[model samples]
Target: MSTAIRPHLSKIVLAPMEGVIDAAMRARLTKLGGYSRCVTEFIRVSDVLLPKRVFMRLCPELAEGGLTASGVPVYVQLLGSNPEALAINAQRAAALGARGVDLNFGCPAKTVNKSMGGSVLLQEPDRVAAIVAGVRDAMPADIPLTVKIRIGYHDDQLLEQIVAGIWSAGASELAIHARTKFDGYKPPAYWATVQDVVHDRARQLYINGEIWTVADSYKAIQQSGCEHLMLGRGALAAPDLANRIANDAVDQPPMAWELLVGEIEEQFLQHDCNSPRHIGNRTKQWLAYLKRHYPEALQLFARLRTLRDVQSIASQFTAHRQQDLSI
Candidate 1:
């Protein structure tokens, strides 16, 4: 690993969440503070080298030195079972200016698993090793190569084998989501299981999943005994989460609904695509995540859910802001 890549291993990172945490969302979150890096939503590479446009479409930061406007590095994540194709795409992304590459073996989505991608690879440790070795060999030696996986597929039986495979295969870092495929997203993340596996081989292991607040962050660090963390839904639920974690604060001041609306509008405007419905839907998707942190977000989402016009939603934000200021 290059000297540049090693420093990032210790920093807090944002997880690559499909259909969420796009370039705009990354820009929004990183600007709020305290994320050392963010991973782009996984680009599915099954066969053939994906076009440059596909990478840029998923991660516009690729065109901007692979860093958000806030200067946080954004690594491109790839999900697939084909070793050669994944290597081809990883090289392509690096050539196109990706700061790093993350292989996804942890996503438990049914469609992804059924397609022989994501956590499904956990059942075949040799396949996982092959994929990691292929990508690591294909990319420049200086660019960091990382693997993300769940504890296991059906249970924790394969946890140690999987980590051993990743480490032996030349991956510079490993991130484990503290649950098996059977565990899904519900039930608290089993941090103790992650701790048990990482305890023996501590080389750059990052714990991810269910780290929702500053307290959760502390508990995860204490229990998992891993200092590095990757935030997913929790970061989406509260954009300032990484900032709070970095500052070691019990709580950051709540963002006003009006300010949150402004951030959403900014994301909408940053999306240069021609689909207004797409923009509206992305806004609503983010608002849905925010509902977990802000009750006002629920009311806002309810008011905006039926609207297909992005302009109409923007107008609603204006009205809502006015109402909020008056109060």
Candidate 2:
């Protein structure tokens, strides 16, 4: 691996969550300042080549200079079954100025798995190898290529095959989500399985799944014997998560309503997010977690959830946020 890729092996990376980790969320989390890199939500691939507009939509940060406002590089992830389609899309994203390209094989969403995407691909290591090879061949060498996969589909029956195929296909880094497709989002992420893989494979390893606190992160880091972590839900639950792990507490401020409001406003203004309904949907989803830290925000979230118009929702959101701050 080139020097460009080695540093990534030692740093914490934010997992690419489909709907949850939008540019706004990335911007907010990156501001907390611990992630070495962030992967944008997966770009679903089709048989036909994706238009530039589609790539832009999946990863708006590409046009915003390939990094979130916090100056963190965002790798664009691609999900698909066809090698050609995935490769073409991956290359297109790299050409359009993404920092890197990551393949998603850990998504457990039925909608994705039913289509022979995500963790389902773990059952077909040969196919995974072919797809990875295609994209690696097409993408720039200095631009890192990583793959995220689970331990197995429903079992570890083909775990070795999957890991070998990923390496043969030229995946410079591998992130193991530590559970089967059947496991869903439940507990016991099987960090031992990922630890086993790291012991065997020469590729870099990132442990993911159910790391919701600093204690959990430390345990994962020690258990997996892999320094790198990819936080999915944990970072969402606590915005300062990455900062805590990195031991950089200078900006480790609490998740106040003001910070949340500023992030929402920045996302709305930059994305030209006009639909109050759509904006509320994203804000409300985040509010569910933000509420945990700042319980007072829940009233505003509940009020905003009922309103259909964006204007009313925004007004209510603002009022509630202001009230929370005042209190």
Candidate 3:
């Protein structure tokens, strides 16, 4: 909690990382401060409009006025190539009280691509525009429609055209992940490439990629020339990242390793994620990211890695928290 503050110039959004950043994580992170908004993991849309339960299961925040507990608006994200199906689904999400709708054209999973969802659609910019326009037309004009995408599917050849299509289709905002589908999560996000693309000033454009720290945030902004950002694994790696970047205060130390471990233990014991069998699963998965920032996570992960039973993990939490008494 260092007082060092530099005052950042743009918005910091919590990126949607599918299974990683769910509602509970959103609540915890948003409550910590500095995120302008959060986007839910993509809700897969296909031939038919999904049931209301599907939307509820993915984004329970919709029940709370589409805002996280800290009042950060949560935008419902839909992934699909079918314009009609996506449109109806987007409409349903809005009806269910979504603050906004985001179209995901950037996921790189082979299974998702094989199904003609995610990055596979980048091969056809016409359909991309059509999908955006369709979803836009179906939802209320006041409900914002945002689009997220990689530079391209296999290469960035269509990057310019695809971005133009998204804006022309009336997307309220566009977040570019700064890589091609083939690039996956590789390093060296070509933030500089985005500097060359034509951007719509009237519409917000967000640059997203390997932004793991405050220094990287500034570099990405300087290179991409985009004022805003969407943080993904980077945010999980350092949970207070959005605040640090916005406050422009890297001098402040990150959340104490012990404090963060305490928070994870509490979140773990809650058991409110995907399923019962997956109780400690999210905590373990998160440690995989946390280890990148906090070495303590690695030691804790080693102890809890093999345990799935609640009692076993809870016991580990007890031992971990006891270290505080010694201090």
Candidate 4:
């Protein structure tokens, strides 16, 4: 082992990817082991307080005490610019059994930005602080309130100010996506920039973006100098990445592609059969990510890319699984 010092990495959070990583995916990924927590897709809160049904629908884990079947905490994520509205809905989530609430200030989608909901908020550090402070105060102190943000809006000019404001506003944890909104999921996350500004040892920090393998995680930790990480698309690309990183098995082999495809198929069949038009879209999205790691995933994606029906996709999965069994 190298003698250079490395982060202790006490937590690994499953990043909330909108239209992906829903309740079923959370359950499946957390079940495979080594995740400390999961976050729901951001529930868009506007001027009104959303109903209980909305909360329950986005985060079914609220019905299960804010935990997946595997017992990992699923923090309810809320996105909006209205501090009052955000606070009210956040408290509602807590009252509905959410153990933690995450405020999303990092989404870069044009629709979200135009609505003044996501990274657009980063342009105004005080507004971000107000939203975080308002939500934090409304919720029980015992319930953790976390904030997620990109490094900045168009540049890192306000990075220090933003980080300071969120912490000063009482956010218990801050997860930085490491890229400015202008960068938009591109390469060069500037992981080391986090170490340059955020120096508070009292609060936890999770570094995200461009981490798709064990080697990537290692470099992210060393460069960011942060102890915790948030896995986004990387988690889907390699479903066992959490376990691999947790165990420090840098060279550990990925889960067999056959077994992974089978698990994906089972989840799709169990939780995704209801919506006819959207039957195989989510599975295909996941396969796109998985293809980055497993050649079989690419081949499978090619096979199912043109198919949209549940029956057809399900049949392909059956053949895929039977072939694995025969092997």
Candidate 5:
């Protein structure tokens, strides 16, 4: 059995991919093992009070040990620049059975950064402190409040200072994305930067960025000497990658085609939409990274995109898979 450095840190956390890591994705990732925790995509924090249904929709697993089907605890992630509003919403989420709260400070979406939310907060360390303080104060003491952040907004000049501010503001832990807001998922995640933070600060560090394979993850752990890691695109690229890391095994991951097809069928089946069009579109988005795992994934996605409707696309996908299996 794998042991975590801290009880809260999962050896593998499915990165919070907006629109891609939905309830269905969460359920599938849970079954794959190796993932210890998962966070929903960032929910917009509005100045106006949100309806209760919104909270339920954001975290359906809260009713059952704050975990998805695979029993991994899922944290509800909130994204906004307003400290007070974010705090209020954090409390509401906790009261509604949320086990933990994750504040988003690293989202690089143009709309989000422009709205003074997500990675934009990195531009103002003091404001980030206030936001963390407010949410930490509002949430229950037992409920851990964590924050995810990039190095800086446009430059890394303030990265160390921002990390300090988050810690001072009562954040229980921090997951560093190992790059600046401007890096925008580009090449080279600056992993060494994260190692510097862990070596210098007393805080627990979870490495995120460019860890696509077991070897990549191992090298990161070796370089940083930090055990905890968070996989964003990596886990999606290979569902069983985490199991390989947790077991310290060198086995290649399971065939990506098998996992992706199964996840697509399972997620679409859960919806009541007149057709699976909406869900099918979601699958295409994930294929951005998933295809790299299985070359055939691109062909499958291309076939999916050609269809005009979800039902037809789904039928084609299923029929093709059945044919492949029979041969």
Candidate 6:
């Protein structure tokens, strides 16, 4: 199979972050302009074949030809330990309109790892290979099959072997988070280590981790020698990080906190959720990350954290907008 890393393909991608970069966030971020593609949060696959509703719930972009409103493609990601089950779900995702399928072998959450899923598979390179091969075979050739993995579970000792197995299994692209499962979300992404293993592979290797700004993105590119970078928390913290990185700009010019809050409001209103509590929690979750970049966001989160009613949150956002206008 041909590699997905084409010579012309050098762009930033949104990382598949569970509970964060849902369909609403993807549409909002892509609309801001920068991300080349976005991956949905990992759809957990267990024993049975997941239904279309599950995929739809996770990635509503599937209903619109798998592209965000701004035209960025969204890939559906799956996480599980069973090879056949993963493949069956991958096939169903494709049939239901997933433009691409990404296999997740890099989630390091204790709960996920304990369940014999996520980065725990990194300890078993053979199982990773089999899972990737199964998914690759199950999906249509037109839809790209990608894999996301950490360097290793406990260490980078088997990094090379893991990469080799993933490529041999016919993954079109590979994203290395540049941290061991044990490393968690610490500083120092170990970008330099990936250089020794990449060594002229045809597959596209994306470097992800600890990139919080455009400067960090440049440093990651310099250290990893990879032009393609994936943004996770960094994008969440600074919503315009991808735009700045794509434009080769320094960083987003300071904007009013109310504008950012309004964007969040827009996203929340657009989302098709049955409960206002879900929207309220989602808004608070976004504000928690935004606090990293905007002090006002911290204040906003503090005010809204205890509120379960979406209308109350929206009222606060309205007041903030009015306050900004008054100023």
Full ranking by TM-score: 4, 3, 1, 6, 5, 2
lDDT of each: 0.84, 0.79, 0.87, 0.88, 0.78, 0.83
Candidate 2 lDDT, tens digit per residue, 89-187? Answer: 888898999999999988888888889888888888899899999999989888889998989998988887888888888888888888898998889
TM-score of 1: 0.92
**Index of the highest-TM-score prediction:** 4
Q: Which stretches of candidate 6 lie over 4 Å from their true place?
A: 1-9, 251-258, 272-276, 322-326
TM-scores, all candidates, are: 0.92, 0.87, 0.94, 0.95, 0.90, 0.91
lDDT tens digits, residue span 1-327, model 3: 544334248898999989889999999888778899999999988799899999999999989999999999999999998898999899899999999999999999999999999999999998899999999999999999999999998899998889888888999898999999999999989999887774545228789999998878888887887879899998899998888888886776677786677678778877434376787889999999999998878878888889878888888777765653343
The candidate scoring highest on lDDT is 4
lDDT against true structure, model 5: 0.78
Off by over 4 Å in 5: 1-10, 200-203, 256-260, 271-279, 322-326
Error of 6 at 100 (Å): 0.6
Model 6 — TM-score against the truth? 0.91
- For lDDT, candidate 1 versus 2, the one ahead is 1
By lDDT, the better pick of 4 and 6 is 4
Candidate 1 residue-wise lDDT at 170: 95
Q: Which 10 consecutive positions of candidate 3 have the poorest summed lDDT?
A: 1-10
Q: Which tens-of-lDDT digit does each residue in 1-327 have in candidate 4?
A: 443333465488999998999999999999988899999999999899999999999999988989999999999999999999999999999999998999999999999899999999999999999999999899999999999999999998999999999989998898999999999998979899888775754248898999887778878887887778899998999999998888876777789886787788888798878897787888888998888888887767777889888888888876665663454
Backbone collision count in every prediction?
A: 0, 1, 0, 0, 0, 0
Q: Which one wins by TM-score: 3 or 5?
A: 3
Q: Please, what are the lDDT tens digits per residue for candidate 5 over residues 147-222?
A: 8998788988888788889989998877888888778899788877666667544336677888887777866665
| Candidate 6 C-alpha lDDT tens digits along 1-327 | 322222223588899999788888888888877898899999999989988899999999988999999999999999999888999999999999898999999998888888899999999888899889988988899999999998898899988888899889999888889999889988889988888778776238789999987777777776776658899998888888888777766634534565677687776666623484475777778888888888888766777777776667767766665663453
